[model samples]
Structure formats: structure tokens, C-alpha cells
Target: MASTKLYCFAQSGNAYKAALMLALTKSDWEPVFVDFFNGETRGDAYRATVNEMGEVPVLVEADEKLSQTGVILPYLAEQTGKFWPADAKARREVMRWIMFDNHKFTSYLATYRFLHAFAKSDPPVVAFLLARVKAAIAIVEKHLGTQPFIAGNEPTIADISMCGYLFYPKEEFGFDIAAENPNIAAWLDRIRALPGWVHPYELMPGHPLK
Candidate 1:
């Protein structure tokens, strides 16, 4: 396997998805810290040299540079041949959950948490985001209630992608899925028991906030 480096900060669950996948796969990898809290991601130098999308968690391996947790997770799954669906239909199932995660689940929850906690935005805006977050979480909670994993019976890249932000502290979003959603909680426990599973804070830098 080629050497892998993930551009990430500890607070970024987006980066955490890629970082966690690398860890779970037991890949030879290292994290290049991105000072996201200081606006490094917004700088022109970083945009031009790194993601160009002003995003952290760019995965650099061999001669390829990949951005977006949705893409990076699948790429790593393919490379490692570890957390992938067994057939075409199953792969489509994985993609469905991954896309749902980006569009509805993690995206809404991340935005809500950022505005409500990190950015400390207005109450009106935070309330609006919170509605979306709750709706998305309900959908995920319902799905997890019936299935052991997001994609199917086994865990896949889809599970990793969707779970990117789910492991973060409940205070960030002001709710605890692990406590309120039994199935989701059980699934999280399973992921936690994986051989190399580690919390996002420990897997990357920039913890405890500055």
C-alpha cells in the first residue's frame, strides 16, 4: 500500500471520516494538521495547493489527491478492499446511504452544530438549522432501527461516511443519539468495538478547543 496522508483537524468530523477509515483499515498513514479554527482553510495558498474547495480532509496518496469525505471514504474502501459491498447491488446500497449522509444527515447536523455552538450564530438561524437536523436524525434513527448497519447486514464505507459526525460530543448538537435511539446506539457500539476504532478527537489534532 502507498503512503497516505490526511489533511485534517481534530474538530472536523468531515476529516474524521477519512482519518477514521484509514485507521480502521490499519493503513500506513499520517495526518497533516490543518488549523481550521484559524481560517487556514480559507486562505488562498491552502485552496490552491490543497482542496481548492476550502475544505480540510484532502486525502493524498500516491499521485492522487481526493477531497470530500463521501468520495474519500469509498476510495479508501476500494484501495483497502476491506469495507466495501460484496456485489453491485450492495455497492449501490452503500452509495445511497453515503449520499443521504452528505445531503441530509451529517450536513444538516454539522451546520446546526457549527451555528449553534461553534459560530454562536443567532437563535433564529440556529433554530432553523436545528429543525433540519432533527428531521435528518429521525430518518437515520428509523433506518438504523431495522438494519444492523446503514447499507446492509455488514458495515461498509457508507456506515463510515454517515458516522463521521455522529461520534462527536452531544453538547455540540445538544442531543445524544446513543441514549435516545436504541438501534443507532447499538450500531455505534458495534463500530466502537472494531479492532482499530478510535474517537475522532484522539485520531486527529486540535482538541479541547483553543
Candidate 2:
């Protein structure tokens, strides 16, 4: 049996963050598919047994059941000694970007994509989110131009966290993000070339939302 189990669905970018970390680190892990679209996450059984927060992307190892990609990514890095900087300063930089990702970058983009593709939220709401997403992407685009990765020269958990949602099809997002940002596109290409890289859709279960 795999030593780690990640409760996740294919379409969740947050889940992808943890899944990607496990993959890139070459951890002996397996996915426990979460039926997110069919209201599985919100169910009482899942809440009682898996996570009280009722969220996907929970990482299970022995007796530890850890939720939130912010926690999962760093835990995996610590355990595997991959995608984490050895330098104390660089580790702080990684945390900074990870916080930024959870707060601004991934938060805005994931919200916008969810409302646009799934919720079919009102245009005004979608536009509001899109504007913020663009703003966050602009910051990343500029930052990536100066360095090959988010935290520094080496690929770290920050890069994994930031690129969580970017790998999905443009149709789902209703726009081509890479086409507009050359720097981000190149950065993504670099990440793609890494060993054990896998697309989110193929990395987990519950694709097509049915």
C-alpha cells in the first residue's frame, strides 16, 4: 500500500497543489477520490470521519489527517526533503509566496474560475473576480521575469502552490492565461519539464464532474 493517501478530486486546484507536491517529491502516495461535485465534501460522513472542515485535498499518513494545501505542501516537503529550500532565508521566501498565493493569487483566480465555469455567477461578480485575478497574475508575471521560480532559482513548494490552477484547460477559465503572459508561460514550461510532473486531471480522480 502507498504510505500516503490524498483525498482529492481531479478538478480541484487546491487539491492539485498537494497532489503535485507528492508527485514531484516522488512520494509513495495514492489518491482517495473525493466526489466533490456530487456534494460528497459537504456530507456528514465525510465531515465526521475525514475532515470537519468538509474540504477536499486532505492528506493522510498513519494517524495524521491533514487538510489545506498550505499545510499539506509544506508537510510533504519536510518529509521528502524536496521542493523546499535548505536555506533559512529561502524557506521564509517560500512561505511568503505561499501566503500570497493563498491570499491573493490562487484565491482570486480559483474563485473567478469557479464562479465562471461552475456556478455561472452573475457577470458583475465574475468581472469583479477577473479583475483581481488579472492583478495577481500581473504581479507574478513581473516577479517571474526576474527569477526562474517563485522563491528563488530552485523549484519550491511556492511554485507548486502558485501553479496549482494554471494547468487546467483555458476553456474552463474562459481565457488563455499563458498566451498573455510570456514570463509565466516560460516559467510554466520550466515546471512542466520537471521529473514526475503530471496534469491535475490525470493525477487524481473525479474528472468530467459526472
Candidate 3:
């Protein structure tokens, strides 16, 4: 197998999803940190190298590159034969949840968390964003009540993709994600207990997860 490299922003949850997959798979790869704040991703050199979209979490495998975090997670998992389900039906189910996360949950909740928690945006906008987040959480809470993981009993690419976004709001924004969804909380605990599980930001001393 050819060597792989992942270029990502250290603080981004989207980027962390890719890193988490690489770690979980025990894949040998190099992680290059892109300085998003300084427009490093937008530079010509970076644009030509991996993603023209100027996004972080670009996975480079030999001569090929992948840009989106959603795509990167399953690709890595499938390559490693670890988290991805083998059955076609089960894989489709997993894809359903992953697509839902990409089109629905992440679009609203992740954006809201990003704008409100980190950007320190307008209060009115934050309030509006919070409402959307609450609605999205309600839907997830309903689904999680029945399913052990997002798609089924075992963890899959869907869980990996959604986990970081789910974690960030609770950790940084003081959002009670677990309080609203008890089942989801249980699932989160299960994933946390998995072998080789590590926080992407573990380099930060005194991280709360410790």
C-alpha cells in the first residue's frame, strides 16, 4: 500500500473526524496541520496540492486526494476493514445515517455551534441558531432512543463522522447534548470506551476528557 498523508486544521472537528478514523484504523500516515486562520489553505500551493475547495481534512493517498470529511471517514474505515460494515444492506443503512448527518444535522447544528461558540457572532443570530440546534437534537434523540448506534448496534462511519460535531457543542458551548438525548449519551459513552479511542486535541494539557 502506498503511504497516505492527511492535511488538516488542528482545531476543526471536521478535520478531527478524519484524524480519528486514521487513528482508529491504526493506519500509518502523516498529519500536516494547515493554519486556517492565516489563509494557508487558500494559498496557491495548497490549492494545487489537494483541495481546490480550500477546505481542511484533505486526505492524500498516493496520487489521489479526497476533500470531504464524510467521504474520508468511510474510505479509511473500508480500507482498514474495521468500522465499516461488510453486508451491503448494513452498509447502506450506515450510509443513510452518514448522509443525514451531512445534509441535516451537521448543516444546522454544526454551523450554529461554529458561529455561536467560536465566532462570537450576533446574539440574535446565536438565538436563531440555537433553535435550529434544538430541533435537530430532538430528531436525533428520537432516533437514538431505538438504535444503539446511529445505524445499528455496532459503531460505523456514521458514528465517527457525527461524534466530533456532537462533542464540540457540549464541550465548548455549554450545550447539554446528553441531557436532551439520554440514549445518545449512552452511545457516546460506549464509543469513548472503545479501544484506541483518543481525543484529537489530546496535545492540549489538562483536556477535560482526561
Candidate 4:
């Protein structure tokens, strides 16, 4: 099979999800970094290769192009046969959580993090963002209370899809995952210690990995 090529922006969690999966699966691929701050993604050259949405985390496989972090996770999992579940029922569960991450978690927490951490914050917007974060965390904590992993016992695409947004609170917001949700906190530590779990900020401009 031909190697896949992923085009991403270094500072983005959405992009990191694809990169992390590639590393975990031990797949051979090329990572092209797009400069979002410089409008590199909107360039004609990039648009021709990726979705017209101008988003990062675009995966190019031969002639195919894929956008959205949620879609990229399962695609990589299915291709590599690594994180995806084999059972029909299990696979559905994996998809369920991935959708949850996109519709529920990423919609709010990721937006909140991007706004508060990167852009100038508005007090009203920050308040609204924090409410969403709390709501998302409550849902996660409830789900994680019983299952060791999001999709149950072993890690799956669900975990990878949610890891970036989940980790953001602890590292950036001075919020402790352990204090907020012990189960998720432990899970966070395990993910952080994973083989290819590079922090997004570490790859940002002028920042060196510790």
C-alpha cells in the first residue's frame, strides 16, 4: 500500500489527532505543516488538495482527501487495524463516541480553548465557553465512571478523538483532570505517557519540546 500524506497545522489539536494516530499505528507518512496564522490553508494550492473548508487535519491518501478530525480517526483506525474494534457492535460504539466528541465535546470545549487560549477573550464569551466545558466534562465523567476507556476496556478511536480537547483543560486552564474527574484524570496520564503523545504547544512556534 502507498503511504498516506497528512497536511496539518502544528498548533492544532485537530491536526494532532491525525499525527498521533499515524505514529501509534507505525505508519509511514509525510506531514506537511500548513501555516494557519499566515492563511496558508486558504491558498489555492492547499484548497486544490484538501476540502474547501480550509481546515487543518486534512488527510490525503493517493487521490482521496479527507477533512474533520473525527473522520480521520476512524479512517486511520480502519486502515491500520489498530484502534478500531473488530466486532460489529463494538465498532458502532466506537462510532457513537466519535460522534459524541464531534457534536458535543469538540463543538464547545475545543472552541472555548481556541478562543480563550489563542484569541483575545471576551468576558461574556468566556463565561459561555466555561459553561460548555463544564457540561461536556460532566457528560464525560459520567460515561467514564464505569468504563476504563471511552469505548470500554481497551483504548479505541473514541479516546484518540477526544484526547486533545480533554487534555487542553488540564494544561491550559489550570484545571486538574484528576480533581475534576479521577477516572478521566488517570486516563489522561496514560494518554500523555503514550509513545507518540506529543503536546500541541510543544510543536508551536518558538516552543521546544521538553
Better by lDDT, candidate 4 or 2: 2
TM-score of 2: 0.96
lDDT of each: 0.87, 0.93, 0.76, 0.76
Q: Which stretches of candidate 2 lie over 4 Å from their true place?
A: none
Give the winner by TM-score: 2
Q: What count of clashes does model 1 give? A: 0
What lDDT score is found at residue 169 in candidate 3?
Answer: 43
lDDT of 1 at 110: 79
- Of candidate 2, the 10-residue stretch with the lowest lDDT total is 201-210
List candidate 1 segments past 4 Å from native. Answer: none
The per-prediction CA RMSD against the true structure, in angstroms, equals 1.7, 1.3, 3.2, 2.8
Clash pairs for candidate 2: none
Candidate 1: residue 80 Cα off by (Å): 0.9
Superposing every Cα of model 3 onto the true structure, what RMSD results? 3.2
Clash tally, candidates in order: 0, 0, 0, 0
lDDT of 4 by residue, 1-210 (tens): 436877775567777778778877778887766777678877887777566887888888877688997888888887889888899999999889888888878778777776767775797997797798888888888888887788988888888888865544455554665696887788887777777666665432322233
Which has the greatest lDDT?
2
